[model samples]
Target: MTDQPLPGAYWRLWFAAAISNLGDGVFVIALSLLATRITDSPLSIGLIATFATIPWMLFALPVGVIIDRVDRRKVLVIADLSRGVLVGGLAVVAAFWDVQIWMLWLLAFGLGVGEVFFDNGAQTILPAIVPRDQLERANGYFSAAEVTTNTFLGMPLGGALIAFAVWLPFGVDAASFVVAALLAASLRGSFRPTNSVPSTGMIDDMRGGLRWLLGHRLLRTLALVVTVMNLAFATTQATFVLFAQQELHISDNAFGPLLAVIGAGSLLGGIIGGKVVGLFGRRASMLTAALTPVFTSTAIALWPVTWFVIAMITVQAFATTVGSILSVSLRQQIVPGQLFGRVNSIYRWFSTGAMPLGALLGGVLATAFGLRAPYFAAAALLLIASLLVATGLTNAALSAALTQYSPVTTEPTFATDVDTEDHDTDDTPVSIDRDPLDDLLAGP
Candidate 1:
């Protein structure tokens, strides 16, 4: 592996992800607006958002096994093609036909199903395309691209475009998917099957992925932290709508600009994650890691006006940016290459599975208690997770746990089930792309 991404493959992934996430961002904001226009109930929108996790939760594990056993490139192409059709077909229904709330629910269900394959394939396939040491850079680039779409371009563009024609955003969203599918079609490389574990049956594959995750203490801890954060954050999207409507006194469709502002924050945060790892040192990164969400959450709890709310949302995006880079890079650095797909699948499943409950709890709290209450709960949970991680692992230990390539690493393994980057029993950054612990695995 080299320090930079394989130029061609990386660009291919970049274009595909950018176009797809852009469409997704646009569709999500538009969907929220559509639901509100069709019915006055915020709760319905909230419920719909809650169930958004169903695809990831239900299909993730199976998708992981599939990613492991099949050619990753093929998986991506097929998933993108399916999604393009679905989005385009839905656009017609939303644009021309009458759309019921239940229909929207059904659309969500189908979209969720495809997401399982797409999301799993994307993350698991990334390491194969880039050099090992570039994990931070790769994660940063990916997050930055997504932020550009959802925040800088997609969310605002989608909402603004919708004012022209209700179907415009949906149509645009559909178009993005088609473009993504085409881009995916060009990526080379068939994740060639190795005789390592020998492809097994479905139930065995599931058990293998699960068993791998449970076997490692660091990964176990990391999974728990990620799951908790996701559960707490689940209430965020629903509560944000309430806050915009009631507290800020804004219309449902007008928050697109604000969301875009957050995208800027996310962009900055993501760019800094790579620099932060080098400057602050990974050990010190943990305590500082807690600040962005804390800042974002506390400010939102204060109930600012539209401008202030925009700033707070920006902070949340920034926090998400940094958090994503740190966690993802850490996992990529540590996880065993062979089982990386399986372990990541479990992680996705838990996060997505928790989303529905989080959404429901948020909606309930807003209607029964108050709109701002969910923010308080979300902030508290983030704070707690931060504290637990700090108290449990020393900074040096934590850094090593995250970046070390040895068997001491707790993340899931890669497909090759081997680490051959630096064969010596040394424990330092071996090269620009190779970590000291990489040679421990019996991989290709």
Candidate 2:
């Protein structure tokens, strides 16, 4: 397919993501700093990160069901508004006096709840806004915007803002959410699933989503791999500040620029990610992406120098962005629209949800061993995950799965033999093909 510009609605959504992530990037740095200010312990920092991520494990299924049943635009609006008010309120509070760690933990949890809905809605609506062929490009646009705002502007600016006033970053974060909400409201057309069946009970709906994922061999294995990788990644998130401060001797004032460099790497990756995927092909691209963190983490662990670590992070960001563009585009193209939210949530429930555990592990490992220990541990875990992908995710396997996949259709059953109920709202009848790879990929 020839490359074409994405539709206006998609760009609107893209703009909204850019705005929101810009604030989110600032919020990440600000939050980490706030935690460090309140308590210098690694576990305290881990707790902050855990509160932000564990919501995915707790609410992914329900949020997915909600995204499927409602107009996705409304979901985005609500998420943005709620987050704006909540974080904005925190800013107001912090302006008066020193904020407490307990308060940060609570606010982080609340923001995470909003993210569960917002992120699911954001992913679910992409196929509706853009055609299947442009998915990689569309995703590339979104990733670029996200990394730029969340990392490039947000990270360094956050550090600077904190230096100006501790509460300033939070205020900026609140404003970004408000702007994002407005952008989301301008998007036209219905985003609800056209082929979704009536409620088969929340449990059944949730079960159906999980079963659909399990029925797809490649999808299932990928989700598991994402989970393990996320766990390793989170270790860095939870303790990177301490590592930079203690191990590398970077001062607080300069930390933001260093963090911002990570975003700079990701930004470059996002801009060229689709091209990389095209040149490398899916399997090779994905393998490279999977192994990237392994090598980067190892370099940081072994060398622990400032310049070397920065270079590795840039390479890691670039590789992961390419992989994400290819993988997310494939999933969006193949999964039925009605089931996309739920399936994507299930996908995230594994991939994103595992971060809390990793964060906790980072704290524990750092406490028991040393700050550098988490990097060593992360490298080890990532190496094993990469090896798994190299052995299991072959090109033939991906091609076979892609061959059997189609957009979600109104059918009596999904990828498995699970019974499906028809709704009067369905647009057309479609059935998902069950590949024999299910048995092999899903494991015994």
Candidate 3:
């Protein structure tokens, strides 16, 4: 299974996501730049970022349930097409008249809603396309394409496009989404979940997904570690601009290129992720991911030098990307197909839910203890998170969780599902086992 080439459809999916992310890269920078034209106030910018993220906190669970019930491909197509129209409309308006701050906020929220659906659908559809043995490779490829487009190429292109015209970047984003929708449509097979049943009410379904994830020892522990790490990372991100200016004395112009180091590192990570995971195994790979940020953050706190920050964050980005590839592949392996969307969404909600709080904390801590304070605080938090990962994500725990946990199995309705059935081939009922953590917590 590992030696076989991925299917043609998988390549198509990969290209589509990559193209879409390229536009996303441009949009991320351009959107904030456009908002600055409206007003340079940090509050206005914060509002834009806030609204864009609000949908994730608000809609992730419901959208997850929706992904499970509907044809997942349709969700992806609809999400892209809708976003295409929305951004296209923004381009038209911006070209004709002055863009209002409120209008930008509205567009951001709309785009966020679309992302909530597209991302979950995209993730949920993968196991259907690739064999379980190949998930790491598949995810690594997807991650590489994404980081290459969105960050490496997208950010700079976005800045240049904005310089060309206020409306140009939005128009480009619109075109990309339209193209992505077409690519999604070209995928030849059905993407409905194998184990999905008729709807049992959204709330009940959502609750079921949440309960399952919370009860699972591996998933639960992973989510906690990610949440804390994300908090630390986001805090650093939120304060970085100020920290760079005040502490490192990085001029405005050099900031973007310096930040690009993160993208470069992620690109390198994505390319190497499968091999690293293979060589080191999941526990050590995950531990490496959790610990690298500690060193990077501590360096920033201690030195506040521009070149040092760039180098350290580059390493940090690589480590984080490796962690992400492995963790996502692990979840995709174990979670039930019918429940993947809901459970995955719930897991992410917990994992990234700290972002807004961290953003706020970064600002407050920066003001209270100075720009470097956030960095120190982040390093301390990440150190705590690293220790948790070191202790919790052992090879034994991962092995036990993989063997003990089971996804709901159903008869295949689609051709591809039948072919891939052997990969998900078990219909064996797995009884509940005592959580591995209980034994660990009992101190042997």
Candidate 4:
């Protein structure tokens, strides 16, 4: 299985992901630039980021349940189409009228909603499509595609497009989403969970996942570590545009290119992430990932030189991408297929949910101290997270967890046993002789 080529359907999914992420890259730069036009207040600009990420905190649990119940391909299609409509509508509005800060916030929030479903669904569906031995390689491809399109190509293109007109980037973003949607819809076969049992209700399902994650030491620690890491990173992200303009003395035209430079490291990391993990092993890889940001954040805060900042951020992106690939692959390998959506949502609910608060904190810090304040704060927080990772994610612990929870068979249940016609596409329960989580939890 490891030597075999990835199936054609996987490529279709990959293409759809690449195209949509390209639009996302464009959308991120364009949105920030537009917000800057409306206001100079760092707090207001930060609020836009806050709105965009708040949905992961608010809606992740329910959306997780929804992903497990429906055809995941349909979820991906609907999410893309909805985001396209929202972005297209925003483009039309921006062209005709004076765009307000609140409007950008609203648009960001809507897009965030679509992302909650789409991201989780994509993660849930992958193990079903490719062989288990190839999960790391497959994820590396995804991470590479996302980095290449979203940041490398999309970011620079966005900077150039915004120079033409405000509405242009948004329009391009809308079109990308629509095309991605069509490709997602073309994927064949049923993607419903095979081990889905009679419903104990949504709340119960959510609790089940939460309990399993909380009970597992390795995963639980990783989730918490990611939460702190994201919090620290988000603080820098919320204020980075302002920092570039003020401290680094970068021009608006150069902003996208600077980001693209940072992305180059991530692209490299994504391309070689699996190999790095295999070479160094997960514990060492994860520790490096945790520690790199601490020095990088401090360097940017102290120096703020353009070349120095780029160098530090590029290194930071590389380490972060490697850690992310390892973490996601580990989760996919360990968690039961039926519980993947709910557990993943819970995991992200903690990890990504902290971004809004981080954004708000960045805004406040910048307003009170200075633009550089957020970077200093991020450095402090990330240092603590690094310490946690150093102590908690030991090589022995990671190996034990993998040995305990790895699936008994490589074949996914959805490949054969799932009856597409009779699949319960709603909250209604179906009978199973034993709970999948029983086996998962029973492992020591």
Candidate 5:
């Protein structure tokens, strides 16, 4: 069946996401550089990331319940507006004063809190805007926009602005957030999930979401694997700036461009992700995604050359993007829409929640051993993740999940005037072979 064009509301969401991500790209580079100015300690620098991500661990579950209860659009707008105000305040403070490390840590924590709400709301709202079959393609557009704007455009811009003044990038980031909030607010729709069960108290709602995810073997296993994968990635990421500066001898001016180069691969991955999944089945693509990081991390650790490290990171980003697209699309296809916010939150709680610990671990490892140590540790962790994907997330298992939840018709009802009726033209189910989860559950 020919694919229907994405709706206007989807485009608005896309623009909001792109603009905000652009700001994030700039904010990331600026924040890292600002933290470095305050303190050169690897542990101290890593703590910035730890502070930013700690909210995911503390607030994700309860926030998930809130997402299900509220209008996701309002949640997104409020989150963006709040971030804008907070960042704007930080920028004003940075312009006048010599910002301390503790101040940066506090700002990072505030931004992280906003992210916990904005990101989860955005994901939950997508299945409502776009059809089930078009999810991969729709997600591809979002991923591409995020990478292109955030890294390709915003990152280099951030580095340049930071060279001029530390406050500049933060100002730009704040403006972007405000603008994104405006665009998000313009999206005319009631984005509340229409089919959610009546709240049986917040704790019970949270538990129901948790139980649904845990009971599903594939999603459960995938969530655990991602938890470890995020840990490995964060471990390397926490001290990457130090590695670039101390080892590769990259100047702050050049650091953003180098990240932009690595982001080129992510851009490519987002552009072609849907096609790649179509070409290679989910199993092969996921396994490839799992294994690519192992080699890349090992190579970077061993070589430590500027060009070589960039090349390795670029390749890893491509594979990782494809894997991420597949995983999100799979979840949207199978999970009930009413439970999407909660389930997705639980999944992120397991995966993203590990980042703070990993960031701390990276700092400790880099401080005690060397900058190279985190890369080696990442390689080992990724190897284990690869094996888990190879053994547990087989093609048969993925197919079974899809078969059980075919023609994914349980989506949040949007009150928009734009006609989305054409998006789901093909509702025919594919033939199911067997219950793949049953075999896995009954394993020897």
Candidate 6:
């Protein structure tokens, strides 16, 4: 059967996620500035950043259970609405009263908590709205929008809003949350499974989810790789603003274009992810994607503040996007329907946990070695990161599995999966017959 069009509810979720991500990006700019204004210490900024991320590390698994148990639409609506109010409060504090550094940490924590639910709901709800066949394209576009909002728009817009008034982005951000809330609440279809029995306890469910995630060897390896990548990503993020300003002499004006280039690359990469996934097959793409980040991040560290880093990162973003989208979509595709949420949580927890540590470490290292040194460290980590990913695919667990489970190599899995589902819709490179994992892990 032809994949039916995405239902109205799914559209609402997509739009809501997009807008909410945009607002989050703007608020990040505001928070960083607030930290700087309050205390000039890199350590303080790192601490605030750590707080903002700590919730992700702490609450991801619990949040997944909540998302799975509740009406996802409602959970999304609540998250959006709550964020709107929280941000609005920040705006008022910034505009009408003096806001403390601790308050910034509080706000960041609240936002991060809200994000746990929002993300869990978003990832789970999509499968309910669209046919299994169309999930990749949907994921690709969704991933692109996220990159656009977080990496591309968050700082630049935040900076711009701060220029107009430090409080303005928060106000606008609050308003965006309201829009997102309304959008989320307006979705029509019910997403919860019909089974009357729900998990009895939060802790039990969390452990069950974690067990399933870690028990699976392939997924467990992938999670470890994700953790390393996240650390690299967080470290770069912690240093980027300072690096841009100090090394490249990138003013507020120049930063936007530099980021925009990366976003554009992501957009292109997103559009083409499905084709690549189909051609390279999921395993190869994941390895490539993991490795590509190292190159760009290393380039960022090695190159003095020049147009070169921007150009390199832009190219890097597209390659990185291809790898990431493929990796995520592949993980989702292979995960059993029942275990998807928890597995994602497991992946998330590992990845998210790395952020705070990376940011904190970046600050410490930067202080000692200087701004450029962190990038060098990050680059070396990324090269090691690539090896970690390569090891994951070749591991004993995947080796036994891939040898027995041969994909239809001749016609291409992408042709079958895509033709039946999203013919001509995806730009991802996919070749059905070739399994990179199988190549190395040819088995017993």
Q: How far is candidate 6 from the true structure (C-alpha RMSD, Å)?
A: 8.2
Q: Give all candidate RMSDs, comma-separated.
A: 7.6, 7.7, 7.4, 7.2, 7.0, 8.2
The predicted structure with the larger lDDT, 1 or 5, is 5
Tens-digit per-residue lDDT, 179-253, candidate 2: 877766754455565566689688889899999999988888788777777788888768888888888899888
List residue ranges in candidate 6 displaced over 4 A.
1-13, 147-156, 394-444
Instruction: Give the lowest summed-lDDT range of ten residues in model 6.
Output: 435-444
Which candidate, 1 or 4, would have the higher lDDT against the true structure? 4
Candidate 2 error regions (>4 Å): 408-444
Local distance difference test scores for all models? 0.64, 0.73, 0.72, 0.78, 0.79, 0.64
Error of 2 at 44 (Å): 0.4
**What are the runs in model 4 whose C-alpha is more than 4 Å off?**
1-5, 408-412, 415-444
**Clashes within 3 Å, all models in order:** 19, 3, 0, 0, 0, 20
Question: lDDT score, residue 50, model 1?
Answer: 59
> Candidate 1 on 20-39: residue-level lDDT in tens?
67776778778777777787
- Expressed as tens digits, the lDDT of each residue in 1-444 for candidate 3 is 275776655665676667777887777767756765676444454455556656778899999999888777788788888988999999999899999999987887788788778778777766665677778888888778877777778767877888888899889988888887776666555667555678769999999999999999888889888888877876666545556656787654454555566577888888888888888898898888888888888887888777777788788888988888888888888887778889999987776556656666766777767777777888888898889888888889999987775442422244343344343432211100111001000000
lDDT of 2 at 43: 86
lDDT of 2 at 97: 81
**Candidate 4 on 182-201: residue-level lDDT in tens?**
77666556767666677779
Candidate 4: residue pairs that collide: none
Please tell me which model should have the higher lDDT, number 2 or number 4.
4
**Candidate 5 local lDDT, 196-292, one digit each (tens):** 6688799999999999999998999899888888888888888788899998999888988998998888889888988888889888988888899
Say which candidate scores most in TM-score.
5
Judging by lDDT against the true structure, name the best candidate: 5
**What is the Å distance of residue 276 in model 5 from its true position?**
0.6
